[model samples]
Target: MTGTPNTKIAFKNVRRVFGDGPSAFVALDHLNLDIFDGEFVTVVGPSGCGKSTALNIVAGLLGVSAGECRVDGDIVTGPGPDRGVIFQQYALFPWLTVRENVEFGLKLQGKEKSERRKIADHYIALVGLTDFANALPKMLSGGMKQRCAIARAYAVNPKVLLMDEPFGALDALTRVRMQDQLLETWSKERRTVMFITHDVDEAVYLANRVIVMAARPGRLQEIIDVNLPYPRNDELRLSPQFAEIRNKVWHAVYTRSGQQQPALEE
Candidate 1:
């Protein structure tokens, strides 16, 4: 696949296999995709569809069996500060306060205490955690904890954000709120984001393009473009345009041939 100047994350005929021998399983098969700079892309598919595997490859946590993955024209060999990752579970340091947690990456980079405080304060306020900056992780609710995690990721100023089901663990109401909050932050930061989720509404609501994968040697099944405008809200979610795009993604994920349907919530 040819990459353009705007391509922030490029997967060039990528493949990933687990184990060695006849019993080996292929997680990804000849996947080719390019996520442009400042684009919000969401990936959705049934279970075991290499959704997380692909995110891990971009994050440099896993190696591809064939082909290559690149960030900003450089091949990814391992994890780097240029890419920030957020998972379903809030991976905050329990012993640390929100400000300290957000400053952890900067501290690791040998940033002085004063500079770390300045950067941490900015992201903490951006995520609406300014009041809770001194509170420990145990003092925050699930949604608040996730917000703190996001603040921490942004504090490092990564060019790309790889999120794997980051809102999966939250309750329904909180999940919706978190989605809006994330979009607001993204609009201001404009970082390239590759978010993986199982929810169809979320996949359509938060993405410029929704990537649907097919299981059993996971590969791309379809790419549905969400033509809706930005600054999305609850009213937009109820519109016909939103419903049409959501249905397209739903059909692409569930109606594939010879695939067992998994229990996925809309």
Candidate 2:
């Protein structure tokens, strides 16, 4: 499950503006980033610092107001099967059973019923949801629902996984478990991953490199290399190396947040 170590996605001088004229708000400004093939990168920033905005741009859900976003050298103009997105909200269809929810994308791809079922079953088992495969979304807990969401996103076998706070909604204990599950899944799948989160510790633990973003015209403030061994576990969380990286990320975030903004001219 080692990454290819080549550039898989790139953002060049990217900017995103919502609305226009007097009501215009620039969510991201001159954002530049490069995500390597099969690499796991986590982005952390203040609430309004465009953490999700950057992720959406890469997912092709939102258009950049300036510059360009490219996946494997191709400009990203729309959502494609090559990318899988998991949001904070589970977004599962209550009417669909767990297996059916995972098969949704494969079905749309015109995959045969038998083949779809095979793929669905494999990912469901991967997420430890085989026992609940026949269960409905309403019957599951918050953590189980998110597991379903992960299985659905991975069932398509996307090359790049875009996760926006996928574990944010779970309780403390469940969040830790989900984090472990995610690492195990990613290790086996070896896909390029970009995760967005507000938790500095989560960012440090999960990412190969952590991108710290500044507020206002959101932009990259710092990128901290994790330099930790793979097959990471909860024990790593208590390691001094983990604490070091976490503190570094926190310092960057704190310094940026405390900086005064320039005055606006009338």
Candidate 3:
């Protein structure tokens, strides 16, 4: 993970606009970025700054209005199993049990019953949800539901993981805990990740690099590298170096957005 990590994802002069003519609202403005393979990059910005929009383009859920977005040097045309997405709301099927939800993607791929169960079980255990595998989505807490979402995303063996504020709905305590859980999962399975979040602290804590975007017609503002030691934990959050980087990102977000105060606390 040194020198150059080989660009797994690249956004070249990309632009995304909604509507047409005078009513058009530009979400992204010629934004360019490169994410290396096995790199964990977190994007943070003010509301409507195209953070999620960028992730969606990488996920192939949305097409760019201009230029191109590529994964592994190929233009992102549409969604593929190689890319997995975890949304803010846990996109689980209520009709399905926990195990079933985890296996949904595998089932879609026409995996045999036993193989689906095996992959689902492995991810369930990885996320520490083995005991709740038989439960329904309604029975799980916010944190637990998110864990299920993570397990489901990882079950398919995606090469890239796209997460859009997956822990935004959780309580402060739970959000911090989920951040650690997600890092642990990523440590074991280092997929190229593009995570979008509004929290500067979360960005600083989890990302190898924090990508800051400007508002209106969103564009890259700055890239802040988090040079902290790996295998990070809650104790790292209390470190002076961590606080410094967090504040740096906070200031960058506010400055880029022209806000007098931070939208969220670190």
Candidate 4:
């Protein structure tokens, strides 16, 4: 499939399957999607809907069984520095301090020690982790660990961020704060982001558009545009507009195929 010039990530009739023959399971079926440059897109659906599967394809952690997954017009063959991935697990190195963790990718790229330090410091500060730069992962709270993971991803200067339930493990209050912090960072950095979440509120709160997927052999069930202005906060979350959009995403996610209702409108 042809993608527009502005498309940063494109999935053309993508399909992914596991196993073979009679017991084969299809995770994604003929999926087609486009994430534009500098746009924030959140994906939500029930378990086994391929939300993470799609993100994994973009991260080059998994291969598509059919069709293509492209990044910046190039076919995705493997992981590259241009794409950064964050999962629900912090995946931080227990032996490394926050600064070292953030600098890991830069070190792999053969950056000078001073240059890596500067970049890591900037991103660590960006994620509000300046105070813990020297602390190991064990010293951080769940939210703080996630923030460090995010900072580490950013320090690499990726063009796109593929996040799979990055805030899922945090407490309610912490999750809310992380959402705001992430939006603030996105506003300043403006990278293309495709975040996956099971929470409808979180999906609507953080995305330019929310992608809802069907169960099993996942395909796009609906795409809801979030027209609300950004710099989103707790005050915005309490607004009726936010609830409206949240409900739309909720219905799209929970409503089953045969019982699907008419789509909601603004």
Candidate 5:
């Protein structure tokens, strides 16, 4: 009604169980989440907390055993171009040029050679790698390679961007830079994105909303509305507000892990 608007993606009593019959292990338990279009949401929790599994379910790579996951008003069935995933590992083709790798999806769609080239270059430049468009994957830095991977995902123009610790492989400094670059690119592209990361700080820094999940037999623990304005840079990271969100998320994680909740910093 007059409260929150309708969600672009909705998980209705979703339950995901792997294997079959008695052997089935439920990853998500009666989970319900609503993600609005163009929203930047981050899932953070303990390892193997079904965070990635939730992303996979939304991507249609996995199916729910008990409920339905809907995207744009339709139930999810299987992997489709509507979702683009970026994994922790830079899943780039070592053989393909940055441009070729970025445009690979368009090429697969049988777009003409020139068409693919134009599309690829646009995304390459979007990631600030226009000069490296001709370089092979092995030649780029770890951060640059991930940028290409991000560009590759963005090139497809998916309705949702699913990222699983996409910066988990980079060094601390590099990770920060990548976070800034991702925010930069996302601001321009405005695609609905769901990212999974274990870092509470990263989750709070980038997300418009942060979802914290419980451990195995993973279930939603808390949903935090960041409500932080755009152009969030390192300066924002230094604010007391940012620390408050981080501490809140950290406490949630600690509590979920069966440990005492951490105290908030003064």
Candidate 6:
């Protein structure tokens, strides 16, 4: 997708501080970012690094202390349907069927029952979970549950997708599979994605660009491009170019995350 001169998401000198007066804590300092349409940008850092906080701000779930965030040329203030968020916890309605879980947002927006069903079915198919549409969350696997969460996010036709470690709970094999599924969906949908992940390979594989955040106060440390072609699969992971990008992101995370940080083996 082509982008206009205007940025899809802009974070200009943004800062988020907690509390008031002497007891304040700065979560972000002079943070500036510009995410373009169809760009998959991954935010990575160690625990308590405020990485999730950045996603929260962009989602309009949290207010910024300073600076501003704009999505599609409009200044963000409160939560809107333009931005869809998928969190680590699937957050599905346990009582609802997988299809109903995906349709929840549409129902809230006053969509007709039949229309919601169609939309839900489309998304479930998109995530390759068509067979589980009638199943309940309690009956699905962890990865499948996350897929439902992703389907729910997409059913709304959001302008930007914000994911905060959405697959962190899955086992290693499942995490890798989910990552591939996400890449496939994104390649087809091309939605502006701002994702948070601690997995270096996942970030390198899925992101068009990687943004490394420092721990504690959380500030941008570096921005690196991932020129890996779309539809990255296990084969791409074994290639040299992928290894190079992976190394860069790994080192960026390692140091920024305060690890020495190991390099993504090149």
Evaluated with TM-score, which candidate comes out highest? 1
Q: What lDDT score is found at residue 188 in candidate 5?
A: 94
Clashing pairs in 3: none
Looking at model 2, which ten-residue stretch has the lowest summed lDDT? Answer: 257-266
Residues 1-266, model 6: lDDT tens digits: 21357579988888999999999888888888899978899988766668888899889999988888889878889899999999999999999999999999999999999999999999999999999999999999999999999999999999999999998899889998999999889887779999999888888888889998887677888999888787778899889998888778777777546766544433
How many clashing residue pairs are found in candidate 4? Answer: 0
In model 6, pairs of residues that clash are: 254-261
lDDT of each prediction vs. the true structure?
0.93, 0.90, 0.92, 0.91, 0.87, 0.88
Q: List the residue pairs that clash in candidate 1.
A: none
TM-score of each model, in listed order = 0.97, 0.94, 0.96, 0.95, 0.93, 0.93
What are the root-mean-square deviations of the candidates from the true structure over C-alphas?
Answer: 1.3, 5.2, 2.0, 3.0, 2.6, 2.5
Tens-digit lDDT track of model 2 for 60-91: 99999999998988899999999999999999
lDDT of 4 by residue, 61-105 (tens): 999999999999999999999999999999999999999999999
lDDT (Cα, 0-100) at 62 in candidate 6? 95
RMSD of 3: 2.0
CA lDDT, candidate 6, residue 261? 51
What is the C-alpha local distance difference test score of candidate 3?
A: 0.92
Better of 2 and 4 by lDDT: 4
**Global local distance difference test of model 4:** 0.91
Residue range 140-170, candidate 1, lDDT tens digits: 9999999999999998999999999999999
Error (Å) of candidate 3 at residue 160 is 0.8
Write the residue-wise lDDT of candidate 5 on 41-99 in tens digits. 99988776799889999988888888888888888999888889999999898998998
Candidate 2 stretches with Cα past 4 Å from truth are 1-5, 257-266
The true-versus-predicted C-alpha distance at residue 153 of model 1, in Å, is: 0.6
